[model samples]
Target: MSYKNILVTGGCGFIGSHFIHHLLKKYKDINLVNVDLLTYCGNPENVRDIADDSRYNFYKADIGDYNAMSSVLKKHQIDCIVNFAAESDNNKAVSSPVDFARTNALGTAVLLEAARQAGVKRFHHISTCEVFGQLPLKSKSKFSEKSPYNPRTPYNAAKASGDLIAKAYHHTFGLPVTISYCANNYGTHQFPEKVIPVFAIRAIQNDPLPVFKSSGNKREWIHVSDHCSAIDLVLEKGRAGETYNVGTGLEKTVTNIADDVLAILKKPKTLKKIVPDRPGHDSRYLLDSSKMKKLGWKPKIKWHEGLEETLNWYKNNPKWWQPLLSRSNSWK
Candidate 1:
């Protein structure tokens, strides 16, 4: 298949930016149209290498707008649409459920409608494992694509609703859609509000590390680079109307994650404090990504190495993150 033009929503955000960088490097002929709202998390600087590239284009627009999306789709001649745009932060979602519903759920519907109208070849919905709700830490079975949706937080509920809408489009309209539910992604270009980068920033500043919900909550972690790699594989080779799980299979508690971050930063573990957990915080989240692996896709980056690289990125790029950290409302 000679894929040419592709659209990646939320392109300047963490995983989306990394995905765009990876795609541009690997596929020489592919032209990219990245649509993002420049929300608190979306930073164009994250993809500066390709900013000047002729193959890449960006539009600062919200996906919730149908006419704007339709215009962009028609103008770009987009062959594939990767829906990565979403409101993902738990705290933010709690405080602003309406915004979450608008972006994650309704915005996805708008994109699907546009893709259907534009007759795109493939539409991939990038989602999180949190939509499965809390998996018990002691449970032996990991969540598969067959798991029932049980979103616990406003953020995840919105995402779950979006997934349903995508599924509806695929089944009802035959929109040629695929969904990939991924574990918690940690890597470069991630905003500081997320767990990994937040801890790294706090540790770097010798500040207190806030451990929500006793720091006992466990989660499977995947590198954003590995995530992007899987997403690319799916876009290029995946079967339509199917859901794939993307993860590193590394399940560790929040405390363990904090310890690892401290070790990476050469800081004492004493910096961590058990703080009040977020409302409806999932106790554990793990995904069985073997389905994608069976399709010849596997994660390449290990957590330790990936974590070290992420720490180095934040340490070296204070200019990029300092301004982000100063925005207390966004971070909170």
Candidate 2:
């Protein structure tokens, strides 16, 4: 499936920006349209290197605004829509459930309707593994495409609702839609509020790194580049209405991650501070990405090397992230 014009929502964000760069480099003739609300986490500087590319265009608009999204879709004659716009910060979601629902769920519905009306060829919804809730530490379970929805956080609940709405559009309106539930992603340009970036930045500054609870909670980690590759595969070959889990099948505990970051920076381990866990903190998250693997997609980056590279990125890119820390209180 060749796409001439692709509409990518939240393209200013971390993973979205990386995907946009990937798309541009891989397809010379592809014209890319980025629709971003420019929320707190959305930074245009993430893709500043490609800002002047002729094939790339950007529009500052909210996904939930039907008229706005419709205008962009019709104007671009977009054949594919990759919806990445959402309020994804879990802590912010806990305090701002209404905002999460409006963006993640309602916004997705609005995008689907616009895509359906505009006769878009493919609609890809990027989701997270938290929709399956947490797995027990000793459990051998892993979330798959068929995992039942059991969202425990406002963030995951909104995402799960968005995923269902996307599927519903496919089933009821015959809209071509594919959903991907990815594990935790870490890479350059990620906002500092996320676990990896937060710890890396703090360790670079020689500040205390906060570890939630006992830091035993575990999460599967996948590099952002690998995730971008998986999404490309899904968009090219994934069946409509089918869901795929994108992960590296690698798990790391929070303490382990913090320790690794500090060690990479040669910072003392004493900077590790055990903080109270967030409300409704999940114990573990594991994903069985065999379904996506069957599509000939596999993660290329090793966790250790990826972690070190990510830490070095934060250390070297203070100009890109330091200003963001002051703008938002969520960084703490």
Candidate 3:
């Protein structure tokens, strides 16, 4: 509510679209300018329901385009920029590392520069805990802000680069920046490639669920709505030049997820098909969300309730998720 007009990059994507909806519904006086490239993953249907809202506007443009970014910032009188734009798939990164770097690294730099030129009041960058590398599967260890970057894949390395650039802009240029490394997000409107959706969609069709060889890879899952709430808090109350980890501590293995999907949809356990794991696939990812807790922000979604609702969403919305299945490659 403090910022009258906010620019949300990648607003058509899963998390971004949810955040945009959260902001518009929570703050009546605010205006949102959604900037998205509408890439293979950025579906307009994610936010099409709000297309006619007087406070919402969408612009199709790449985040790396400085001229276009700067123009939109000024044209919308944007006071803050929440960057959610990036090439998010690791499978794609395997064959196209440069493409990942181009958007995740260089594009972030360009957007930060544009924000500097436009004198935005606040700049919040979205990041992943994968930048801190994999943790031992059985250990109690978790990723924190103080952890060093040890990205395993090209996609994560590029995201790590983007995080560094955001910190640099804040320290060197005095940009009011706050970055967040959130846990794995699961909910409706997510591209069908990620583990949860892949299981849900396959289970609905009684198709074989592709489970990575070990299928024991563990990751903390946070409902996308909770992640959006944390972002809202960071934008409003977080200190500049700081990074916060957002997670629910609801860690579960990929096998556990597939099982849950199978049971939820009354499918047989035999639907799980063990597949080869992808390169640079981590064994575990858990975040120490003490910082976000200190800020009085915590996730509210219960795992069973949240996951079931998410799976049911994919079950009911086949038209939206079914078409995108072909775009995904064999990935963990």
Candidate 4:
């Protein structure tokens, strides 16, 4: 349960950074090695505060590169691996499906091989409920760990492949792997490409905040901190080859989310503009997190509370998300 040296892939990203912080704060004696390829969304500044700690080390490497992953594992003498590396943008995945496949599928395969060779004690993978595809509007249905995968987008398809690959390794090679499928995450340090930050920044600038006209489409949202905590609990008590779903039962349409962000910034409602929905956009994503709750992890932050706090974060820190606008604004 206690990992002496844990290698966290993609630790510079939003959710991964939060997980690293959680681990460092909870376990003082453990050392962490963060491996991030530093893609457009993966910013080192996200974890800059903890970069100087003696207990932390970082490497810039691709998870798909077997040699690089093996090197990092051996150098850090990692006993546990927590993987977050992926090309996660849905819109971008539509245009560049190959890129997503390489990272989500091939990258996972290579990482698992490296972990098996290193004989790591545990390998925990983070996943999305989108892999289960959409639910009907206003439906009570939710994605359980047992739900059949119905990925609608190239991104989710690739992620589904990665999850299957991980499971295969556990079944065939006896690799100790635990996977968690979570609802969408919102929190501080999230890339501007996401909904909350995009709305907040555009509202701050009095620019149009784009929203698809899918009034019935719903998405379950959970605070990044809550999701991170779920992963931590899994590492401690979860069984290998088992998958858990993490969510708060919180569902909201994008229109509602845009309105909330504007309200938080005291901006006018006119800032919200209806835009054409992207290709392969799922109509809904809901998750049944009772499995995770059974492990003593539950969502702590409410939707409005988390949204306001997240918008405030963007308002107070322009330097962090401003530079990202040009880097990944188009997501091409």
lDDT of 4 by residue, 1-332 (tens): 47899999999999999999999998999989999999989999989999899999999999999999999889888999999999998878977899999999999999999999999999998889988989888678777899999998999999999999999999999999999998999999988888777788889888998888775578889999998888989999999999999999988889888878888899899887888888877888888889888889878998888888888888899999777888875432
Model 2 whole-model lDDT (C-alpha atoms) = 0.92
Location of the lowest summed lDDT over 10 successive residues in candidate 4 = 323-332
Model 1 misplacement above 4 A? 328-332
The Cα local distance difference test for each model comes to 0.89, 0.92, 0.92, 0.90
lDDT of 1 by residue, 183-206 (tens): 998988788888888899899999
Error of 4 at 264 (Å): 1.2
Off by over 4 Å in 3: 330-332
TM-score of each: 0.97, 0.98, 0.98, 0.98
Compose the digit string of candidate 2's lDDT tens values, residues 201-306: 8888888998998488899999999999999999999999899999988999999999898888999999999988889888999999999999999899998899
Candidate 3 local lDDT, 174-193, one digit each (tens): 99999999999999999987
Worst 10 residues of 2 by lDDT: 323-332
Error of 2 at 330 (Å): 4.0
lDDT of 3 at 276: 92
Alpha-carbon runs more than 4 Å astray in model 4: 330-332
lDDT of 4: 0.90
Error of 4 at 256 (Å): 1.0
Comparing 2 with 4 on lDDT, the higher-scoring candidate is: 2
